[model samples]
Structures are given as C-alpha cells and as structure tokens.
Target chain A: MAETRQTELAHADSRESVTPLGPVRRSRDLRVYLVVLGGVMMLADLSFIFWVAPTDSILGDIQRVFYFHVPIAVMSFLAFFVVFVASIVYLVTRSPAWDRLAQASAEVGVVFVTLALITGVIWARPIWGVWWTWEPRLTTTLILWLIYVAYLMVRAYAANPNQGARYSAVVGIVGFVDVPIVYYSVIWWRSIHPSPVVGPLAQANALEGTMAAVLLFSFITFLILFVFLVAQRMALRETEDRLGGIKSAMRRRAESVF
Target chain B: MVLVWKDILLEVRSRELVISVLVFGLLVAVVFNFALDVTPQRVTAIAPGILWVAFAFAATMAMSRAFVREREQGGLEGLLLSPVSRDAIFLGKALTNLLFMLLVEMVLLPVFAVLFGFSAMSFTLIGTIVLATLGFSLVGTLFSAIAAQTRSREIMLPVLFFPVILPVIIGAVEASTRAIGGETTVGLGRWLPLLAVFDALFLVICPWVFSFVVEE
Candidate 1:
C-alpha cells in the first residue's frame, strides 16, 4: 500500500516534469532545435578540424586529432561533475528526478570518456610510439571510467529502483572523490620512471593562432553537443520511468478487478 | 566501542574470517612467487609489490563479508533500532575490518620476511601498513554495506572497492619499497602522509553517506 502511494506520487511528479500527453511531432519539440543547432556547429567544427586548422609543420595532420580529443576530455569531466552533484542532491532530497539526472549524466560521461581514451591513443601511437602507456592522466581517466561503470552496475543489480538510486548515489559520491587521489598517486608512482619525451596534451598550450581559434570553436561545439545529448537522455529516462509506473498501476488494477 | 566488541566476540567465537583470509594471503604470496621470476637479484624491487598485492587480495575477500552476518541474520535492523547512530555502525564495521586486516597482515609479515629475506617488522613498514589499511577499510566497509544489499552481493564488493582504493595500493607499495629497500635517508617520505590524507578525507565522507544508505 505504501509503495502504491509512492508510485502515485511519482506518477504526479513525473506528469508535471514530462511532455504533454499525445504523439508529439519531432519538429515541435525543443530537442529537435538543439539537435539541429548541434549538428550544424559540429559540421563546422569537423571541417575546421580537418581543413581549416593549420597542420603542424613537424607532426603534420596527425596533430589534428587534438581538436576533438581535448574538448572531449574536458566534456567528460563536466559530465561526471554533474553526476556527482546530482547524486548528492538526490540523496538529500529523496527525489527521483535528481537521480534520473545523475543516471543521464553518467551515461553520457562514459561515452565521452571512451572517445577521449580512443583519441588519446590515436595521438599517442605516433607521438609516444605506443598505443597506450600508464601516463598519469590517461590512467586516471581510465579508472574514472571503471568507477562510473561500477556505479552503473550497482544500480543494475540492486533489488529495486529506489535502492538502486540510493546505492548508486553513494558510489557516485565516493568515485568522484577518488579521481584526484588516483591521479596524484599514479603521478607519484610514475615519477621513478623516465618521463615521456612528449605527449599530445603537452603541446596544447603552444597552439598557433588559427589553430587556437579552431580549438576554441571545437570546445563550444562539443559543449552544445554534450548539453544536447544529456538533455535528450534525461528526457528518455523520464519517459521510461513514467511508463513503468503506468504498467505497474495497470497490473494492480487488473488484479483487483479479477 | 561496544559494537566493535560485539564484532570481536563473534569473530573470536568462530575464528572463521581472519584465518581463511590469512591462508588466502599466504597463498597469494606463493602464487606470485611462482607466477613471477623472483630472482635473488630482483627481490628488493619485487618484494613490496608482492606483499601489498597479497594484502589487497586478502582485503577484498574479507571485506565482502563485513556485513553478511548482520544482514543475513537480520540483525542490522535491530542494531539500527538501538541507540547508536548510523555513523557509529559504519565506524564500528570499519574499525573491525581494520583490526582484522591488520591481524592478517601482521601474521603474514613473518611469512613475507622468510620468503623475501627482508625484515618485515620494521617501524616504517608497520606504519605504512597501518595507514594504508586505514584507508582501505574506510572505503571497503562503505562499499561492503552497499554491496550486501545487492543481488550479487559477494561478486559486487571488489568491483566497487578496488578502483576507489588504487591510491592506497600505489601509496603502500611505494612506501614499503622505500622501507624495505633500506633507504634510511628517504624512508617512506611523502607517500605516508599522502596515505594519511586519503584516510582523513574518507573518514569524514563515508560515514555521512552511510546515514543516507540506511535511511529507509
């Protein structure tokens, strides 16, 4: 009975937060505009990355990967930061919406982190002469990926949805807190080994004028895309939860009538 | 303290957890000994890594059981209903885990000493063990509580535990290397204090999260 009431309350809460009841056309939704805007900017961003940005005199066009790599790295951090904050708020407020926000951010963050890792490897294979090395930054980002993946697993194996949210909130908070410590410890451990001659990240500060402008534009483009993806994900989760609530309510009513 | 005592009495009655974990640690040492080519010339370099790996394996196995009894026997709700705050419960379990872990480590230290021919009872090595184990149990106990409620409870602990405690492994191995290497001048430098910081931060954070964990 208590759960039935809570589901009713969730029904009310989600109804206000979601779109109006009906088949909404794609063009009429706000996300369509975001998708359109993000797509146009991303097209420009990719063109600048490939053609507009001056190739490096020494490294040649292989250096162009940095345009996407750096911004994707930055956006992953932003996404996880949102997860951390949303998690704390969800725990304190006991609100499912905040947990949904955290779930959305973590899903997006995992994708961005994977992209960043792949691009870093593409840049490293030429520069460092290896596909991967346990560089402090790369290792830290990899662990961050593991930590959030574990966060998702905790939710997946949890006994119920509310328990999943509560438990994953705990994991989210601790995992974000672990990131800096992991970086520092890895840096300390790497200190005894001879440092690499150069990394893609090291050249970031020395970009030429057109290159810097193109990099700056890529950052904004990725930011819009990140926002658009997360907004889209959060909306999808809200709809899933509402539909789940409706299905359970209908099952309960049918049992009563029978 | 009463809560800690209760855990102590339970473990003392059975002698199940620490003994099994002790054999597990020693077996890890034996496996690593055969797994790696631990030449006499390379003992100094590889010994600390071996020692800490054994300890970490022991920890994850032991920690997954931290709340099994309370949960399985349905004592957690009763314990929570008593006058103690949830923080007390968290600290109690964390402290119990630390004590059990230290006991296992101390026993295996002699084995490590015989296997690697390094004096494991040195002050610096023991101090490193304490600080690293402090951080380990602090994070481990919290994850244990969360994991105990999951469907795949035992399989879930290390998945949640290891990434968070990687810093402790890094710190402990480095500091233990300095201590065992006989680097008297640079012995255990900033690594020990760094582990202390890891412990201090989690000391305040884990318990606060525990309150929300048991809220309903």
Candidate 2:
C-alpha cells in the first residue's frame, strides 16, 4: 500500500516537472488567493467590528471580540471535522496522505482553539468579572482542546510511522465523536455561557444588520485562514516525509559500503 | 463464552491483577481521606467524587494490564490463531476487564462507605456502577490493546483513555452522587441514561474498531 502511494506521489512529482503551469502553479495560485482574500476579509472584518457595527447596549466595546471569537470557534470546529473525515478515510485506505492531512488539520485546529479560549477569557473578564468560568461552552472547548492535544501526542509518540498513523487516526475519529457528547454533557450538567445571540431564539434583533454581517465576514476570513494553514502544514509534512526517505536511503548506502 | 471464561479463570488462578488493583484502590481512598478534610455533613456530598475517582484510576491500572499477559506470553497470537472471530476476542477481553474492574469495585465500595461514614447500597447505585464500568471497560480494553503495542504502553493508555472517556466519568460521577444522596429516582433518572447512551454507543463502536486495530 505504501509503495504504491510513494510511486504514485513520485509519478505526480515527475508530472509536475513536465508541465510548468500544472498542479504546482495552480496550487501556488490558490495559496496566493487564499492569503490575499483572507487578509482583505480580516481587515474588513476588523473595521466593521471596531468602527461600523453598533456597540452593544449592554457589553459596549468589549462585545466586539465576539466577531472574531465566535468565528475562530467555528473555524476550529471545521478544522477538526476535516480531521475526523480524513482520519476515517485514512483508516479505510491506509493512505499516508490522508494521515498527513488529518495531522495537519488537527494541529491547525489546536491553534485556533487556543486562540478561541484566549479570546473567550479576554471577553469574559470585564463581562463575567472572571477570567475563567466553568460554563458549558468554555468547558466543552477546553475538553475539545485537550482531546486534540492528546491526538497530536499519539501521533508524535507512536513506536513507528505506521503505528502512529494507524493509532492517531483512531484517536482522531474517536475524539471527534466524543465532542458532541462532551458538549451535551456540559450543557445539560450546567450552563452559564451566554446563549446563542443570533439564532432563532435570540433576543429581538440581538445581532441585527452590521453585527451579523461582520460576524459572517469574520467567519469567512477564518475559514480561508484555516484552509491556508492546513495546506502549508500538509506541504511541510510532505517535505519531511521526502527528507526522511532520503536519510534512510543514505543510511542504507553507508551500510552497504561498510 | 469460552474465551471469556478462559480469561476469567486465568485471572482467578493468578490473582495478581485484582489484588494489586484492590490495594491500589484502598490506598487511593485512604489518600483522599487524608487529603480532604471532610466534615461529617460534607461526607456524603464528596463521597461520590472520591469513590468514582478511585474507581477510574484503578480501572486504568487494570485495563493497562489487560493485554500485557497476552502480548508477553504470545497468548494473543494463540487466540488469533483460533477459529474465534475478532469480535469474540474483543468481547472476551472486555468482559475480563469488566470483571476485574467490578471485583475491585466490590471491595472499594464497602471500604469507601466505611471510611467516609456513609452507605447508599441502593440498586440504582449498583446499576450505575455496572453501566459505568461497562462503558469504561469497553473503550479501555480496546485502548489497552492499541497501547500495549506501542513503545510506551503505560503512559499511552491513560493519555488515550481519559480524554476519550471524559463523558463517562462525568456521567458516572453525577449519577452516583445523586444515587448516594438518596434521591433515588431523580438522581438515577438524569445520569443513568447518559451512561446507558454512552455504553450503548461504545458497545457497538468499540468492538468494531477493535477488530480493525488488532488486525494489524
């Protein structure tokens, strides 16, 4: 299975050499587009959040953090969802690429989750008067973060690459499935986190017009950033794999010479 | 059934796994006693948490030991070489782990009651124990198999086990606290169903995943 994949990857690599404007150029173009689009959207989101959106009658300026905070939280979920799907595929096919993708998405998801937790704490300080609360959403997010952290540790500490991929894929899928249960348990157990502000049951015009638009804009921006980071991370993993192959080849050659 | 009996009989003969786990569980309860200054009034309030924590840790110890004998003695290969389906192997190992955990719980519960100065041996509490143990052993056994094959099995099992089983711990702790507090129907009503849901879900999922894991 691995040999076939390596040969297929090598074939694709050779094909990239033959056509100057093939997948390589297209991927490069996509990367550029993602970066540019994400940056522009972020700037627009910042402006709308800081200057355009009406200040909350209750939370004042601090509520602006929700624009970025909620979106980062959403994007983190998206990243982990990708990891979950990729992990299932990897388990079924035993393909190295899917494992790489799962690892990349999980790493990126952890970063975004960290940012979400930090922003959440910052937002909570003036509003809730505490830097931390055992509220449902925050607690669930913390557990989610821990779950992925464990996922990454499994990948890092496995006995071999094959073992790592196989084990971590299982962890990834299991961890993702556990997320909803964690959320449900926390919510049912106790809930102090703010209820949804923009959903159907939200207060009358709680997030009207500019606030909703800014939130939407921020979500799109973070989505783009998520894609860009996962792509960069996956490419780095591929390079590492290629370098590992070369190092093993050199060791084999040295042993043959001896 | 044969495989399950084989594991149980083997455990009964050696007696090492249950002895160590029971002792460890007692020590945990004792440590918790010294660690927390429990007022008489608060004993019932905090007893459930302490008991469940002890059980959770002891279960980890037992689960980590689940496949060690098999892996070391090449008994797992012998089992695999049999005509038994992979699901049977998983069921057998899970049942053995469950039994080991329950044996420790049997001793741990009475010790916990005496040490903490409370007794709530209601059927609801017993039912909760069974359900929680089922959930723990179900997933814990599978992770034990996967971790036993790794470079650092001891550290890997808890790292994988705890995070995955967080819901179980939460559900069990809540339900047991209620059951012990004497709110029989209401207490069990909320948390017991959670345990049932988790156990049922993992009951179907873990064995399927175990087959894939042990195949390699």
Best by DockQ: 1
Q: Write the per-residue lDDT of candidate 2 for residues B71-187, one digit (tens) a residue.
A: 999999999989999998998899988988888898888888888877757777788899999999998998898888887788989988887888888888787777777744454
lDDT of 2 at B140: 95
Residues A1-258 of candidate 1 have per-residue lDDT tens digits of 899767766665555434444423452386788899999999999998898898898788899988999999999999999999999999888777799889989989999999999999998899778999888898999999999999999999998888999999999999999999999988877876657655445587678999999999999999989988888887787778767766676666568769
lDDT of each candidate versus the true structure: 0.88, 0.82
Q: Per-prediction fnat values? A: 0.86, 0.51
Best by lDDT: 1
lDDT of 2 by residue, A95-154 (tens): 777988999999999999999999988987887777887776788899989889978887
Per-model i-RMS: 0.6, 1.3
What DockQ do you compute for every candidate structure? 0.90, 0.66
